[model samples]
Target: MSRKLSGILNSMHEKNMDALIAVKPENIRYLTGFNPSSFSLLLLKDEPVLFTSKLDIEDASQSSKVPVEELKSLKDIKELLKGKIGIESSMTVETYKKLSNNFKANITDLIEVSRMVKSPDEIKNIKKALEIAEKSFEDVEFSGTENEAAAKLEYNMMVRGSSKPSFETIVASGERSSLPHGTPQVTEIESPVVIDWGAVYNGYASDTTRTIIETDKQEEIFNIVLEANKKAVSAIKPGVKTSEIDKAARDVIEEYGYGEGYIHSTGHGVGLEIHEMPSLSQKDNTTLEKGMIVTIEPGIYLEGEFGVRVEDMVQITNRGNVLNKLSHKLTF
Candidate 1:
């Protein structure tokens, strides 16, 4: 907690922000160690305080590292705000309007920027999450409708100790697999089933996707996507720009003359949120750094047909160390 608080304080100092107002639940948990059920706020000054509602006061008092107080309204919170307030970009307009009277709001992502690089404990939780997710998937029976398959996978994750799936499990199969973020339907599971799933352990998340191929054409595209995934993972190293990693995978697909069939960025950071900073894409220029947990997912989406995606989590150290032990190619 001290390390996290100090990092944010130092960053706020550089920005000349007197304090940072953290309203996002994830940000609040990162700082205070208290996950709020109702509305809450963290005033990040030298002497930080967590202001939570009456419903959460008991929990916050017991769990929060910093002092916890009862908040009546935004007016009450405003009285505590000091010079040149720092706010997150995610703050809603209605809330911003209420807090924008006297203070000159500096739209900043101080906490998020700090969160981009994970700590030792955060890494541990992520590894545990991955373990749970992978273990749950190893025994799942993919012999039902897409929606049933999704439900079974989710139930398996919960029984294995995941608080919940990190996000909606992607169980796109057959032609529906062509949709990158497709929702599971009541139809029967088909060949080239794409299962994108995750598990949350102690707030950190593990995300992975694997496609089942049974036809020669599906195998062809699967090999291409697998090549792209492996090449992208191999190219990840400290000091390399994230865009370069995306290009490494994208180049493979483009060279195969299926560049147009490949959609979405190569990957993104995964921790508190499934999608976070340092996006691996053509535009993101953030350099790879140690202690960063990210996903490398490369896919080929063929319209009017099935699609294939292979994804895995990686921790950036001296080089990319793959966290997933599951094989890329899956039978049935």
Candidate 2:
């Protein structure tokens, strides 16, 4: 894991970056073991340093893999700044203005690119997160309002040591499921409830969606979605283009005359963030590689009707190793 620091530094050297400033929490956590409780910065060069505000200094000192110091002020940071400074593209404009005056600040995705591949520890954390989410889901009762079910599942995850839900707990039921990013509601649970949620453990995440169906029409859609999900997962392998995997799922749905219903990308890389690099979409051209973790979630949503989605996390290797063993079909 310490080699990640060296690898990124070598990348900076090749780019002629005199130094790099990192503020994005995930990137900071990737480089340093500690996730910041407040504002923090990572100064990258030959000898990297982690700077955290007074509020986070104690915790940062205890876990930060790199040297930790108090981030006194922006001006103090300026004093240490050098030429051709590289910064994350996700940096806030206000902070960019603070340090832009003295350095040749350039927006770069160096850290994100490096993080696309997972190390063994990262994969382990993601697996633990998946275990928490799946176990919580297994105990969810089909009876109740959408909000209540979501609340129960999340509380169960917390008891299992997941610090929080990686994303909003989605329990979109009935017609509301047609909305790809539907929020849970207080309304009564109905047939065909689409529950999409994840849990976070050790700062890594696991995302999965299981739609409970009762009607014949809903079952039809779910089977088609299941086929797409299976084919896509089967297609994941090192050296294959990410888009090809998406196409594999999309083609299956399109052949079934439901292409338009499959609204979103087939999947996306998962790690510190639910959505990251190497998106499994027709537009993304990144080649799949070993050690990358991603989700295969293909759904068919019919407007004014319910939606059916089947999602599972897969780790890229010689072949896709699906991390979720939960059955795709959920019933009362």
Candidate 3:
């Protein structure tokens, strides 16, 4: 068995779970090498079996680290599942009813918890994704419409070997930058462009945000956000609470009289998915551990004015290591 599968099986054993039914694609991919493009189920026990629809059977057979089988129906899966079945927290209600009937079904996060730390291969993939994204950003000339800029950036990433843009590329410029999750519009590019983009390679992802500023006030706010980012990154270390890292950033922005404007969680874990566990928020108390990769992003939005944000991926060790090589300040 693969190391990941072994580790998960051990976790299940500890919980006295006879088997685990993983319905989430990422969770299934975490245990087996195959990433299901269609509906798939992974029954993990002493000998794990990956069941895929006929559409994916050929691919699953070739790529999976575990045994692969054609899924005839949920009834077949239900029969194989014996006593104390552990199910993922994100399982659909319909699936739960179909496959977990009469079994001791319990929702669990064992797979996600196992994925919190990065393996050496996973780290390498993430670093390569970052490289592709940063290189693409450098090649783009930020003078076109917001939509054009976003399309160009994504195109460059794919040419540089990203599987795809990790998420919707945000190219919010001028006043629109105030919207944290603003979508790129067809309007002409303006000063203070807030570009939050990422690249995915080998299923691992890299997320970052850089604002191109052109005014003294924008620079002032930019510096404050940068300091907050730095302080938060510095606060990351094994044994520290995720909330403390968040406070390190939020406190800096609050000290600058922009607490209310600092509207989101400080950051979140990133891996197979752009957003994962260990969210750096006031309520999350997950402890930092070596080998985990997360983002340290803190931004301030002035309602009628523009916004500025600087984000970088960080790896936890004895101290937090910033992964992006791009400069914090980007000017047009």
Q: In candidate 3, which residue ranges exceed 4 Å CA deviation? A: none
User: Which runs of model 1 end up more than 4 angstroms from their true locations?
Assistant: none
Clashes of 2: 0
Model 1: ten consecutive residues of lowest lDDT: 75-84
The TM-score values for the models, in the order shown, are: 0.98, 0.98, 0.99
How do the residues 302-326 of candidate 1 rate in per-residue lDDT, one tens digit apiece? 9999999999999999899999999
Candidate 3 lDDT, tens digit per residue, 1-332? Answer: 88888999999899999999998998888789899999999999998899999999999999999999999999998888778999988999999999867787989989998899989999999999999999999998899899999999999999999999999999999999999999999999998999999999999899999999999999999999999999999898999999999999999999999999988999999999999997999999999999999999999999989999999999998999999999999887
**C-alpha lDDT of all candidate models, in order:** 0.92, 0.92, 0.94
* Model 3 TM-score, 2 decimals: 0.99
Candidate ordering by lDDT (highest first): 3, 2, 1
Worst 10 residues of 3 by lDDT: 99-108
lDDT of 1 at 191: 89
Candidate 2: residue pairs that collide: none
Q: Judged by TM-score relative to the true structure, which candidate is superior, 1 or 2?
A: 1
Kindly give the stretch of ten consecutive residues in candidate 2 with the minimal lDDT sum: 323-332
Residue 126 miss distance in model 2 (angstroms): 0.6
Local lDDT at 210 for model 1:
94
